[model samples]
Target: MTLASQHPMTMFGPDFPFAYDDWLSHPAGLGRLPEHRLGTPVAVVGGGVSGLVAAYELMRLGLRPVLYEAGELGGRMRSIAFADHPDSLAELGAMRFPPSASTLFHYIGLLGLATRPFPNPLSACTPSTVLDLGGVVHRVRTADELPTDYQAVADAWDKALQDRAELSSMEDAIRRRDVPAIKSIWNRLVTEMDDQSFYGFLAASSAFESFRTREIFGQVGFGTGGWDTDFPNSILEILRVIYTHADDDQVSIVGGARQVPAGLWTRTPGRLAHWPAGTSLSSLNSGRPRPSVTRLSRTGEAITVEDSSGARQDFAAAVFTPHVWTLLGRIDCAPELLSVPQWTAVERTHYMNSSKLFVLTDRPFWRDTDPRTGRDVMGMTLTDRSPRGVYLFDDGPDRPGVMCLSYSWNDDSSKMLTLDDGQRLAVVLRQLKAIYPDVDIASHVIGDPITVTWEREPHFMGAFRASLPGHYRYQRRLFTQFMQRGEPDARRGFFLCGDDVSWTAGFAEGAVTTALNAVWGVLDHLGGATAPENPGPGDRFDELAPVDLPF
Candidate 1:
């Protein structure tokens, strides 16, 4: 796509009309350009979604902004492939966005990228889950439909879901230092529910049929790690996820998840600079003064960025958008700016190392089931494949069930990725048999397990950021106070924006939200200032919405 055809929502923002060709054609090649000023008004660092979105928003306002990305533009939405099996693809991180993600949907529409709704639920319990949960299950079918043995299964499920919400609210209150209040409510529910998992809660409730008791147990049990233990969350969290999973329409990008980033780079008009083929950031400046940058530098003056060949050029503001933990203490910044240790404190947040295995076969390996359930043949799992967690989607639009991708997490994929292709294929075959006891795995299994190593990606140390016990308040406060461009008059004019810095935690939407906040904050600070005369073509800032304080 050309500059003229770029999305007006993004193209004309603060960082528009980037020297498009220069940015992509070479790795570290910033290319030959005229001697512009030292810095513009805003500098956006890291070229991932957050950086791209921030720059795009800024450019829309007609601001001349400069973006710096140490590596490929898309931060974590990258895919991987096996050398021999180039046709097969595996997502290293961020497979798809749910339809309910309004922020993500809005951006997609603005960018004109086509999104295809996923035909399957986020996760479908597999047979392994069934086996693990010992199979019988129940639901609050209806008042009259209720089994004679149980008062009402439906009523019980509702009660449990409500109880969970109550628990979570109490937990949140306690975190806010409401100890007396927490103690008052704790006994009421804690005494009523005690320490029962959802499975145990329902089984002993006397509100379900013997069959339903077993089946519901199986459904919530193996599928999500047996409720309480596997999830360890309030019942509210469980119900919310269950409802969202059921109603939300999650979908994958047309070209693959990685295509989003590729599209951004292709669609955005920015100067592309490639470093010398084999030089690291350290080698670029051999014993010279590395440029001093404010965390949120806002001078409306351009700064020279020297590539490995010692070539230098300038652009207005720079925005930084990389992983909070990885970028912390690595990039140059004022010492006082490093006081926020929240990034380092939560480094060990529960993260799963995952491997996505895509297989191509001519036959429909999955048996068709209830159209609503979409579990015709195979089941999914949060546990080892069975009923706990495995999902299947029809690849009909692509090929004849020719492409199948399975995301294996935790110990399920740990040892498998290290093996040779032949060995990995052998294990997947075995596991598939466990998921579909009736299917012929050995006959039509045509591909090896394609892997994407989360542990290997340098910028991303783990999978998505997760909130563990006692971390919610800390997370909310961190994003609330620290993620902003330094005040224009402050000693350090810097702003941090990324998915890690948003309330939504680990998702693309968070990146946009954070970027939006950063943009508004910077714009407000610079609203009173004037730009240099003869600013380059397509350089200005669009009026952005005022930043809304989160309640």
Candidate 2:
């Protein structure tokens, strides 16, 4: 995969495009530390993918990573199995991943995990998609089967991206690993449209001038489902995903997304710097991580962490990976731990709200054919009603199935935030009944329903980061904070890593890549250095760092 030819575009860059995938695959390994620092301990302040990756790699680099968690081990990759049927489960947080997330896939491959195509609307894996808008139900095998209104919206969106957002040039640059071109085009957009919202950008597009078109585009959105809830987000946030192909051809892990972090926790690395062959993060922490982190502060040249068990430990360096807002609420963070601008970035971080309702079915009833209409009883669905987007999962004819009854975001999720498990299930069933009146959905349900409003989860204050307009500078500050140079002495050893600390906030790749960034940061802070043959993200920081816009 040379830079000369156009390869499939992964999440390399429209922002910081360092080759984390390459660095991870190198035989020389990530870095080396002084003999005295070989077994030095580093505080990993969260158990999410970001923290897990950070700890896993730190261990491989000959450092001990002490893991701490405030809640579940996997965090947003929350998976719960229905009793006796481990295969039948609900993915309450992240369910699908795009191949463009090369860094994340790298870890998945290392863990020897299998993945299958996810059933997105009108995708090859989806048998059918039913769109219900304004009480009218339209079923389609492909987007072409829908009425002209849908086609018009699709065309308008393409036109809007090309004309208003420079979609083609940016995408071409990314596919070619053209960092200069990527930064050139993206930096101009950041400076020019830092204050623009997704809705505002669409409204300004000549193709999306009609109020009706915008409504339809939002309702019958491409890929997963409607994105009306994302209208208030910064346009740059949307463009970065689009430009990186983060929304295309997504797949779900075989068992569950939880396996990613879970694997990291237990699996021993093939190439470790100091630890023995059987050593793993699980073994390092005695098969379980430390309790919830209650406070974080600077203790004279070291980072001090206090856990729920009333244990306080100071580490030479630390990686912070929880939700950025947690620094303000759940964790008592010292004010001196971050610079003023960095604190402002953390303070202004905007996290999107998301809710999911899932149910285990006696069988894959959604695939059953209707006697009269000859159509499947129900298919993957998209509706403007309360249920919003519904996805069907089938194992085998003999095996039971799972269905994500409703996956809603932002304001839609807000309404269900107050609903209990049963209430949430009832709300989805009510709207689903309106669409499939002839089918008795309740009868097919097997076990208890699984529900979650991420915003309501105490540990995770919100689902994931989605920047608001005028937040470009703030986001840039957070993304680049890992470099840690020129920072006040008090904040030097504390590294920030997670999806929110990345250019593309919601993707797990962000968590993994940023974790790698923190790994490089910690390595350097503790007198370690990457092999000259395989430079890490930090090594390429000056050349490929994200475009920083003036405040």
Candidate 3:
């Protein structure tokens, strides 16, 4: 669309306002090189989706940027493969997009990545489900099917989803930055939806008491904690939950999400530089300061970043895109900037744990055989009684059969990730055996299981930011503030952009959208002595395009 619409600052969701190609080719200036260049004008920490988008947007604005990744660049958006069937796609974290994620579809198309409908149909089918409240198991599918006392449990879960649909309709007003109305609605919904955690919500439901029989055990038997055994918290809290057991649209890019950054990195010219191999940020050089930067004292201006070897150099700005939890308490920002109290709720309390496990088989184990009339074989989990973690989607014609993925959250993935590949494969095989008691898993085993846990890596504590009880308002503040010379700009110069800053909460779309905001901030910082005559937002950035320089 027009540049005004593309201004990152005003946008609400994850998708970048401009086309990907236009973003890459946006003109940046030349001829302002410092005597000795260590890093670019910007230093982007952590090369996950947000950091990658930020670096790409900065380069498009004609500014040199240095991207830093302590480990792999993709962060959590990764695809795993089983050793026996290396070709099979085992989605570790997010695997599919809901209809709400249209922006994700647009960006995927822009990248030229091929996408088919998700393989798991289990997400679509309303199967009988069991809720594991503590050690009890309660099965409930529909109101008519509800066990004696627990009919209300079934009713509440369904009603909560309906309420969320109503809440989402208020998006436009919220994005207008109308705090009061939004807060009122938020409180009403939370009180109604979250009187207790999901566990207690279901247990306390009048209908659930009917199902409390000796054979039935407890009312809901889904997740741990007293939260609704099967339903989890209201759909609202479940989506907001920091752990991985989120609704289906958590995404996984085909050919791996790393391609996103790799693609962006390739688009930049030589002005873009990365740390040399085997070097870490602690070893970066401290040399001549950037002539263009004037806010920091000599000590505040630069820090020493040494390589494994003795060599080092100085940098201008360091743009950190690492997980916020890891950076908190570790990175030393000015005391005034640290106004938000460190997150401390049971959920907010920091924990360094994350994991992804990929399970693959020779054919779709769930597919019912019917040679004469081949109907769609796989079933989607509209809601279910089986293990809660398995998600299946259509792999498309290019790949035969179905590709099913299972995701676990919090410390739940520990046992799965720790198993040897063979053991992990066996575990999945055993579970498959439960579904098809007659089939021999040994004959169907096609691949060894594969897994990755971000919590294991010292560089990152977990996936993207999570919303604690009161962090939403502060998160909005993070997006609006801009960094200034003597004081934090009314719009804080050190701006925040990411899922934590977007309307989507925690998704790739949020990161891309926030980057759009950061780009305009940089432009606003250097636009001119006086506001450019036509500086109306996104479109005005084009009018202030930087001078061309020979690469």
lDDT of each: 0.45, 0.90, 0.42
Candidate number of the best TM-score: 2
- Using TM-score as the yardstick, the better of models 1 and 2 is 2
**Models sorted by lDDT, best on top:** 2, 1, 3
Per-residue lDDT tens digits for candidate 1, residues 1-551, read: 64322412211111011222222223432112222321233556676677767765564444545556566556677655534544444555676676545555556764577776653322321221222233322222122432443334345555654555363454344334343454445434433443344444445544433655545443444212333232432232233234323133457676556665555443443332222233322132231212322233123334334333344454333445665555443443433433344444435344445555555454556544536655444433333342133434344534434333345544545665586656655666676565455667556545444455455555565555544444444444445433333423332234566776654444676676567556544554343222333221112222121122233
Model 2 spans > 4 angstroms off = 1-6
* lDDT-superior candidate, 1 or 2: 2
State the lDDT of candidate 2 residue by residue for 96-159, as single tens digits: 9999899899999989999999999999899999999999999898888978999999999999
Error of 3 at 407 (Å): 1.9
- Better model by lDDT: candidate 2 vs candidate 3: 2
Backbone N/Cα/C clashes per model: 96, 0, 72
Q: What is the TM-score of each candidate against the true structure?
A: 0.60, 0.98, 0.63
